[model samples]
Target: MAEWWRGSVTYQVYPRSFQDSNGDGIGDLVGITARLPHLAALGVDAVWLSPIFKSPMADMGYDVSDYTDVDPLFGDLAAFDAMVAQAHALGLKVIIDQVISHSSDQHAFFRESRQSRDNPRADWYVWADANPDGSPPTNWLSVFGGSAWEWDARRRQYYLHNFLPSQPDFNFHNPAVQDWALEVLRFWLERGVDGFRLDTVNYYFHDDQLRSNGPMPTRDNRPPVNPYDLQDHVFSKSRPENTGWLERMRALTDEYPDRTMVGEVGDAAWRNVAIMAEYTQPGRLHMAYSFDMLGPEFTAGHFREKIEGFFAGAPDGWPMWAFSNHDVIRHASRWASHGAPDAVAKLASAMLLSFEGSVCLYQGEEAGQVETEVLFEELTDPPGIRFWPDYKGRDGCRTPMVWDASEHGGFSEVKPWLPVKAPQLARNVAAQDGVPGSVLEFYREMLAFRRMTPALQVGRTRFFDLPEPVLGFARGDGLACVFNLSARPVVLTATGALIDGAPCHAAHLDAGRLLLGANGFAFLRPDGGLGLSAG
Candidate 1:
């Protein structure tokens, strides 16, 4: 089987935001199938659909209620099958999100488990009695906020919910639960889906002893916005026992041809790099990604450290790199101060794609999409609604994708699930289709450039000892890639014949000294001696 994901680019489609074909004001499977040609034009290797399984929309499909069926909000299983077939026909692989860490409280299994303690599925979920004083079993906190435990009056017990109270974590300690989770993967694989994007891969297991997690040290001295960040999270997630379950998942995928799995290690306290390494070793996940680059850290040193740290820790393990996704603020807006918006978007695409591993691009990233300012009443994300104003949740980044500059940006005939604002509408795909120097065009050009260059695709990376604001690295011995992470121009003396540069930014190699303008970048052939200039 071909390892198609290595060094490939996967585009993420948030189902509710892509397009609404039925005029239901929400995107669905049919809408996604109609957009496969757009992804093919973008030149991505695969398309990753966010959670579309049956749910009550509490966490916007992340809180799955059914493992085998598609939600009516996103269409039925037939729609999902049609979408997968179309994607495969276009030579683009289909990867769907598997949120098995927890399920909606309304799920039949959870409903049964929460019933009488002697029920057949009673132990399917993590359930425990409260402390003598009637407090939660531990200091564990939910990612959304508040205690991680929810009281169940029927069983007179508190169930563990790492997220919303409506979404309860599964008790992986039970061998039967692991078997059921593996069957969920088999169901999708038999459906013709190419791979799986494991959601919260590390949260599959927890300390069986219910040990309390102490406070973990923070690199930055900034105050915590969410109490969950204050605790160490050692007992809540990233447990060593999770690896055995990963082996089961990997074994199931290995049974299918050309199937792959990329796990999302949402570990902050334990430093995701280490967990990514542990989870992706042979016989486990094919690749793992973390939120290290999803935050507000935009520096050459920061990028170098993360890439270097992963390879140093797990030389044989593969990793996935992504700048922005559905769960966080868009990168274009987060790092806007680095340079012009369009320039930064183009530069970020070039830089992220040029890295040494597989890459994932969120919807509308090709058009340099920014976050929408959602009002309190319009907020749909649980976290944003819980912690309003200060942290306006993920709805900003999860706004509908702008396809055209129509009244609703062509996403829907009616208002979308999330409002489509003016600022986002201005950067629609129709506006940048063939425009010169446009962010969309830049993405197309950059993705094509990466496809034809073997060095940029699967080459080994070696960092240069260049000064700050100018991050330089060589991709194998064939290509040398450098970036200007600041808004000020910088020149570095280097010896290499330019292969691809200047077209990306106002940069040139003259007299062995490369002069790069603000937010500039270059790809050079170290062995060639040809000269290049910017006119």
Candidate 2:
């Protein structure tokens, strides 16, 4: 029988920052292969590797120039094949990042598309003529900044770029483009990859009318760091055409046994979850993740709302939860007000693992790594460079992973692509490896606990209605589990005896009086009676 992905844990590795094998200051396929044992020991069932495809590094591999080959910077195709074999040998499934929504301007299809109006691949990209006034035809804006449309002097037209201009959006409306993209996906499937993590999954198409988007409502106005956020984005992305293509993608994946696809839906609205539900029901993506929990929201109510709302929107569609990733501030820094970094990190790991769907653990998160402050001059992410002080961009979170306290934090023999700050060095893997109760140890124990407990691994969740700042939920295959995210002692009432608790945490079930300490959680079985109290 095929196993469900829900309730599984996936470790995400940003290839560029994971490790440097050849001491080139950049991580590569061999480096990732060398680290497979570490990931396997971390207890993750799967590893989601960021893009390592051939690219010009326009958007750091998000702009793919070739779909079937690895970039020389990362390694050759043989290296990728070796990594895949090694990962599978360690019982770890491999999911590679797939950026089908757009391709580098240097891609053969895009290059040919731009060369002649009558070429076979001419309509492979989203190209439109400029307005009579010599301006872009629409009001769409690029996520990196400025207009999403870039004028192409050669074609006497403007090309659409949902992200950086170098990443030109493909014309999903064109049948040939869809076939080409599907072929690229097939190439990976044939290479024995387990699945894909679709980047910007919703940006595959645009409104064909080229109509300007209307002004975003006042409440929606955040900052203007990315001009794309200044508009409603109705005509720019998340088009209805995307649904059909998603179905097609799903059908393609279904052809392979046990294969999966998890999409990264980059919208801020709660409705994004609903769209994910629509896309993944029966035959679309196997799962989808949003940016809801990645923000500064840390209260129990915030997490409760996000999870409950997601489940409500897509009861059947699995969700992939992550508190930190390559694109945002580390959770320790984002939720620093909660308490000590280690405590918050442990609490987050516990909470995320207890959720009803799949979970993603970003690299370095096991070390309780906080966001490193990168100055403007050292910034490598274009978004951060564009939105300087207000939004420091992602470079802060993209710092190289620290393996030891050695120079360069043992990430590279030479200086790394991104500097490993002193504070991060202190939290390197070697420093925390054997320490009792260290964040890394805590993660290992938690993951091991989840693996042992059927409820945590494959049970259904029933969220309990508890007081504010105290989020409570029950997960069991006939047993009950409860959690309190607050820092204050609270009374927890359950039906049965307390069966287990996390490391360094305790619970008691004497005469129906349950006492849960600050930031504590408990696992229990029903006592068959009601009216329990912690006091």
Candidate 3:
């Protein structure tokens, strides 16, 4: 690729909920193809689809049975080809999600591997002998609840699973496993995919010794509902050998024209950004992102640290930033106390687009979509059900997209996989499609502004020393981006002429000061000799 992703915007489409054309209460490839116009009109540079491979729906398709074929639930290989063709026709790059770290227990490779100790594929997955007392070989814990090691009755041994028991971690130490992964990428490259989004990219390897993970330091009084967050996780993941496997993946992607890859680095907040930096070093992944911006922290220092942390760790590496995705609660709902729903949504868009890297926008975000309140009876996500009231799981964020104000929000004719409530459905596309001051329109305008501003796209970011709740930064040379992170108005003293900003009650310039309304923001170009400070 010619560095197209450096400043591009990608919109994620959760295929299971984007639209259901067949009315089977599930979305398909054909539905996505029909909705291509929505993405094209939204002004995003590319479209990223969640997993569509043959899966048993374990961990919501993160557990794949066939790596090279599309699930009939999504559509056949032909349907995938058609979707790619349509996306390309609309001038959009297509990036598909790839789960290479593990495979479903029902996968042919894993099935045969577990049948016998000496089978040809027995070494394909991480398998170990139990202790004298028949306990697990190691103390690793699954990202889901319970032990990471599962007992196999046939082989009388324990197999490691970083996720659910149905999802077995691949043995990256085995060279054959690496070769097969590359082949799988090659199969998709031949089919004309623009790139791949590697799921749980850093969880590809484990310590050879299979040593136990140590406890992580706690800094709070609140107890943790999930014990997975209580460990150092040094031996279980973030292995040094993952670099070699990433190189192999990069080399394979380099074989095709204009191909790219973005890996998801899931780790401790302290190390995830650094790991993402390492993964995107020379001869590896094109770009990498973490859960830093996708979490509950929304502060000036938090955003600055993450953006500057990636560059500080590896000056030459590239990082992709996102505020929401299929995982975590939507930012609007997560940070609800900061400001009004619409103001917070629009302000977030301006900040994300103004950041100095590639960006990804989740589905329904353009409509200012909030997380749905999924009841226990309607929960389908594994983690949500395992830890019921304490953690409702990701089903709230994975609900279907809202396209119109009509019943089901134009997502499907039959009852969809997830419920579409009135609060979120009220913000549908049909209502805000062409209306000015709407979140959808604001996003369209903000994206257009980012495209014309080279400084915002690929600029050196430097923060202004403003007080808390007021964020200020410089993109390139003259573009000054500022935002009020609180619900109350804030003022800053600056001797600069008001040059440019998105049309909104977000902010304004006065005699010698900048007055920002609640959740207000502005983009300014200053004259010579300009200084900014809190008023």
| Candidate number with greatest TM-score | 3
Candidate 1 TM-score versus the reference: 0.97
- Work out candidate 3's RMSD over C-alphas: 1.3
Off by over 4 Å in 2: 220-224, 493-495, 501-511, 528-535
Q: Tens digit of lDDT per residue, candidate 2, span 140-184?
A: 878888888898888998999988889998899998888878898
Residues 19-119, model 1: lDDT tens digits? 89999999999999999999999999999999999999999999998999999988998898888888989999999999999999999999999888999
lDDT of 3 by residue, 491-523 (tens): 877667666554445577787688888999888
lDDT of the candidates, in the order given: 0.90, 0.83, 0.90
Q: Cα miss at 421, model 3 (Å)?
A: 0.7
Error of 3 at 260 (Å): 0.7
The runs of at least 3 residues in candidate 3 whose Cα sits more than 4 Å from the true structure, single-residue gaps closed, are 501-504, 528-535
The collision pairs in model 2 are 491-534, 495-526, 495-527, 496-525, 496-526, 496-527
RMSD of 1: 2.3
Residue 379's lDDT within candidate 1 is 90
Candidate 3, residue 127: lDDT: 97
